[model samples]
Target: MSDDLLNAQNDLARALVEARLLLPSGVPGLFGRGTVLEDVIERIDALVVRTAEGDGARAERWRFPPILPRALLEKSEYLSAMPQLAGSVHAFDGTVQDHQKLLARVHGGEDYGDLQKQTDVALVPAACYPVYPIVASDGPLREGGRLVDVFSYCFRHEPSPDPARLQSFRMHEYVRIAPDADDARAFRDGWIDRGLLLLRGLGLAAERAPANDPFFGRAGKLLAVNQRDQELKFELVCPITSAEKPTALASANYHQDHFGSLFGIKNADGTTAHTACVGFGVERVAIALFKTHGIDVAAWPVDVRARLWAP
Candidate 1:
């Protein structure tokens, strides 16, 4: 790693320590402070498992696999969508203190003995960040395109210490890649409705609203605004957290021809694929549900309970 990069990581490590993040004793049951988040995850996991039966190996049901390289991040234009949120991953092999060890060591200014080498690569900011390259390297698909159930345990460096805003969470995605624009748009729309159905089933008040990623710089700012106005990106937000503020639980992103063009992902005849993804922040939804339905999972409405537990 470059000296500059190493310094940046060390600085970030220090900051995380200051923030009471970088939990080494293992993240508490805190993110799931109430049992409702865990229960919601149970529902989300069941849904993911059902979705994954057809996803081949990339499915979260099988196993959480090694995330693809950072190079793919460039292809998917994720840097433009969420540059500030992306996690930069690297390893520590040198004799000096590494970022992995830093997580545990910073607590008392003392190192954990027998610290193991961190072979695991970058921190994941979002679950969808891993899927594009895997599809790219798996060779070209048939003209019809492919759909996959991609999900993961993701992490983010929060700008603030809001319990509602966690530093780590589970993310779920129903991603579609099709040879034509219409199919991708259709898939994006399909998930939007499904998300609303889930919300309604839970008796939570949520609506689809235009949203943009936290992109960096002037061009990114304009791009976000344009995207929002055009309704290129939309969020499923619940107005339960506060009377004036709604919590966003899911997102539908229409990537027009972005990923296909960047990664040369095309059909058998070499037509570029149009890509779209539906993203669900599992914990966020659970939090929203908790606030909406109260902390007692057992007391949740019979209809919502059935939907959550339904096959």
Candidate 2:
């Protein structure tokens, strides 16, 4: 990471802001999308839906809200590993005097943001977290498996200047649950191939590589090493802001029986269900497309346009 390379990345970030492709909201890692970027994101999502349909997987589709029950997240114990990135919703529940003081602080240009109290819900950390509990509550699977497609706006507190790393973003996920471990593993492997091909169709040269979550703190380094050693996470990365270091626009993860054991999801024969998921960072892929093919949508390659906007 040379200083010159860092400067170049910052220049691109400024260019995007000037071009109205990105609108900074005075908050780092959070930006308002202009029409052009929003259109690109929508088209990318449509392409994902089309590709998922063509994969011949009969998956139940679901759309989840940006926030989920805090208790549900607590049960998953995600905070134990990644509390640094979690976003909890807060609100002002106060009397008139309290409101007056808060209003005065804001009018006087003070740091009044902390006046809000924590709510019962937390912004969802990942699109797939809300799905496991839903599936588990249904008891054992009669057919030995289940396939589902879920999409949601995920929130993390990470603040960075990189355009691809937003505090709030949408994730499109396809998840599989099965009694046999091999069934889930094979499903994940198949999606890795399909996801790479989908990126190629968009004129993005992506490669599948081993990856790990940004686990928090000292104990997390060991967790990350173990995860990579187990080969549990794979990412489809293409260079967006940097040529040498590519960005991960999508990932395929094998959860094994981790969620199943916690949720009590089981097979009819009484075996814990194995789980796997493939997730696409919708905005990140759109950013890569703009970086690779230029920001002008109409001038993009005809094949790329066709694949994204095809009927």
Candidate 3:
């Protein structure tokens, strides 16, 4: 990160805080949002839904909790790929003596890490993780496969001063499961265009480009290389805090039989289903809107406001 880019991010963060659009929680990348900011997020989400509807996407809607079964995470092999970003849930399931020890440590301002035990649930890392199991449980998919609309609050362990990189954020996703790889690839490719148009329609200067996940370690680097080589992911990016290094506000990904194999999802022909998903970072889009047009929503361009607010 260049000094100029860092300065730009800091300035934007301060401006949003001063405008009461972001309420600092004394933590970087974690803050409460003001009503206007939240309203913008809501409008953006609704606009995506309307666009999906207009495109004849009759997806099954699902809203998931912020956490998922730890077993599912293990089955998905997410820990192997990006354990550094995973947030595991832990709790104090102990005897009375252990409780007394915990309380004593609390009073003495000491660590009580030994007393807590890992729970069955873990914070959801992505909006689409929970959709695979449900789709699998329904048995083999039909001839054409399925489309699902899912929304969830996602968590990652990254702590950054850049406001665009939030530790906890909402993701709105549309996932498609198909029997053929071509269909799955087509879904992702189409979304790359649609997502770009949607953000640009919101008066944002957004661009679409091939991208890769932040896979960890040496082995993960190889995986990321293969992913990029296969053109498995693409992101719609816009300049939120820094124009030089834009933030990815949305992504279109083609997961070829990865989730299907793990979750036992299959097609009518007894082959693993190929999957693709397009996800939007709701809060990031709202932040991009504020950065692009001005913090004051009422003073935004008439056509942009109409697109977001008009009935």
Candidate 4:
């Protein structure tokens, strides 16, 4: 990024801090949201729920903890696909002698990294990861498959000065499990329009375009290219930080049989199911609203306020 763009992002970050919308924790990309910011986020979430209801989507709501079993994450192949962004939990599982050694190192101002051991649980990388296993366990799907509403606090290892790119964030998603790839693709496509409409309803200048995940390594580059070529992913982006390179506030992805095959989710005919999800970055959307309509929610346009805050 150019210096000018960096400065712009920095200025926005400082402005948000000054307005007390974001409480700094002395860590980049990690913040404790102020009450006003939290209120905006909750209102946005409620608006999403209302929109989904208006669309006649009878989605089963599921909420999951921030961490999932490490084995499950491995089974999902997230570590292989985006190892750079994965966050694993670690604990101090040492004997008394080891504890004494750790204490000595701490007192001596030496590194104590070796004292911690990897735990069985890892931070959830996405909101939809936990849904597939439960769906699979419920046995074969019915004719229309299943629609689930899931939300979770997700974690990625990226630490940045850009407030839009948060390390710890909330993702609200609606996942569809279908009997075939065509169904999954169609579901994702429909959500692309819905997502764009929802964001635009909030008075955001949101745009939809083909996109791909930031897979890791050289092999990941090939995977990303294939994803784009297949047009399997689309993002609703807004210029919260910079217009030259907008941030993705929402994404729709068709994960063709990847989760189904791994988790043994099957159709009524025993064929592996296909899956798709539309995810909204809750904090990013709130940030965009604040950036677009100013920090004061009371001052937002009447129509926008009604869309979000009204009954």
Candidate 5:
């Protein structure tokens, strides 16, 4: 590469490092043992599964692979919600001949293969996108649409100095659907209190307030204002690092018929569906828990500590 190109690449790498936000991946993201992060992940996943129990809602195994359609993103208003936060889906597509050649070279550990681009797909910015397609493909929804619990590894483009605000994060989202606008709104409204209750049970000092999407441009500003004023969304938050303020650890949102209309999701009678979601940021909540309980998990409040490790 030319000197200018080399310098540009260096700058980009440096910029990424500065954005601790993307540190979602580990120096060893697979951390185990008595680490604060490990404890948090365990309790959080348990809560999600336990919360799902007795409900007819579905539960799928969790894993991460970045792949989804561009169309679905548009329908969900994801791009408009946070344009820069979306991560690009990538693949390595090589010709048959190229593959054979690379295989031959690697046979001797030569490791000389060009990583040319394959197909372009969008990175899963949220857990619910893939689920939406799965639900919609069955044609219009049956009866009351559907309610699903999904968890996904998501990516954002920002870099936060705080490792907790990583560029990549795990999100656990519960989506509710209904044929009527009132039903959907009720579902969204219900989660606000429930989410706060869960937070308190976990021993965090949490509160609810209207929130924004970090959208861009003048239109985004106006959209945010409208959403806040209309109380279409709310956040469950508590201080993660400092007592001065708090971060949004989770959100309850009402998408109305926006997604249902776009993706052709319909009711049993075939009318458009109404959608709502309550999302949990597993890592961010972990961060909050650590701050609330201290790095020393053993020393946490008796009830909270027992509940966390209880059988």
Candidate 6:
């Protein structure tokens, strides 16, 4: 990392600490958010709700747990794409003797975590992931297709000092299961515009840019490139901490029947449903708001406050 980049990280850390928006928990990439920060996040969440519920579109609201079935995750091919980021749940399943040995190892400051065994559950990486299988299992979709609003606490095992890049966070997604690729693409495009408008309404200047997922391995590089080249992923970004490299507060993605094929989701015509989703990183948006408009919520501009709080 460049010296300037390091200094920027340090500066942001100091700002977060001084404002008491976050408390360091002796762990990198994991911090306890203060009430003020929570309030900001709640405001952002209200914005998400407005977007999801607006336009007279009926949406099925869903809230998923943090952990999902490991088998489902594997079927989704998430492990192959970004194994480094995935977090698997592990638990102790040994006898009492094993527990005694584990305690002794802990007391001696040895490697005691090996006593745990991998469980069937893995931490959910995205809010929309768990919804695919459930929707698929219900048989073919109705003639016009389905729209879902899903939210979940997601986890990734990436450890970093930057508060914006968290290991555990919440994601709110508006997903569309369409009849064909054209419908999916149209839904994604519409949301990209609306997402930008949503941010602009909050007084955040955001721009749309083609983006790619952080795929793993050599083969995964090709996949990432193809995804970007095909314009499957786009992000609404603004300068939160770094002016040169903006942070993505929202993302719009068209999966092109990938999830539908894997989970056997079919359309009314017996064809695979095309999938698309618009995701908002709730905490990340709050960080952007704090950085752009300052941490004092009461001092924020009247328009932004009214847009978030007013009925």
- Provide the TM-score for each candidate, comma-separated: 0.75, 0.93, 0.96, 0.97, 0.77, 0.96
In terms of lDDT, model 1 sits at 0.66
How many residue pairs clash in all the candidates, one count each?
Answer: 1, 0, 0, 0, 6, 0
Evaluation by lDDT, superior candidate among 4 and 5? 4
Minimal lDDT window, size 10, model 1? 24-33
Question: What is the lDDT, from 0 to 100, of the residue 184 in candidate 2?
Answer: 86
In candidate 2, what are the lDDT values of residues 1-311, reduced to their tens digit? 67866776677678778879889898877888889988888888887887788655588998889999998888887887788999888889888988998999989999876778888999999899988999988888758488889999999898877888899989999998877789888888988999999999899989998985789998888878987988888999998877777889999999888889988898888889999999999989988888888878899999999888787
- Those runs of model 4 whose alpha carbons end farther than 4 Å from true positions after fitting are 55-57, 107-110
The TM-score between candidate 3 and the true structure equals: 0.96
In angstroms, the error of model 1 at 184 is 0.1
Candidate 6: 10-residue stretch with minimal lDDT: 48-57
Model 6, 181: alpha-carbon shift in Å? Answer: 0.8
Q: What's the lDDT of the predicted structure labeled candidate 2?
A: 0.87
- Give the per-residue lDDT digits (tens) of candidate 6, residues 1-311: 66777677778877987888988787887888888988888889988888777645598998889999999999999988999999999998999999999899989999976899999999999999989998998898887788999888889888876778889888999999989999899999999999999999998989998875789999899989989888998999988767778888999999998998999999877899999999999989988888888878899999999987777
lDDT of 4 by residue, 22-118 (tens): 9999999999999999999999999887767744559998899999999999999998789999999998899999999999999999988789999
Error of 3 at 26 (Å): 1.1
Clashing pairs in 3: none
Give, for candidate 4, the lowest lDDT window spanning 10 residues.
Answer: 48-57
Per-residue lDDT tens digits for candidate 1, residues 1-311, read 35554454345334433433333234422232334346567786676455445334342222254354666555566677667766656544545555556666867688554354534455666666566666777777665677777677776655433344566677887777777889888878877887787766678788987874667799788888888776777898886434345668889888887778777777777777888888888767765666567556689888888878896
Error of 6 at 73 (Å): 0.9
lDDT of each: 0.66, 0.87, 0.91, 0.91, 0.70, 0.88
Q: Give the TM-score of candidate 4.
A: 0.97
lDDT of 3 by residue, 2-54 (tens): 88888888998999999989999988989999988889999999999887885
Cα lDDT of model 5 by residue, 1-311, tens digit: 35554454344333333433223244422212234455567688677667655345554444445557766666678877678777665455778988787778878788563544534567788787777667778786777557887778777777644545656677888888677889878877777877787789988989997885788788789889888887888998886544444678889889877778877888778688888888888877776676567555677889887766778
Model 1 steric clash pairs: 89-122
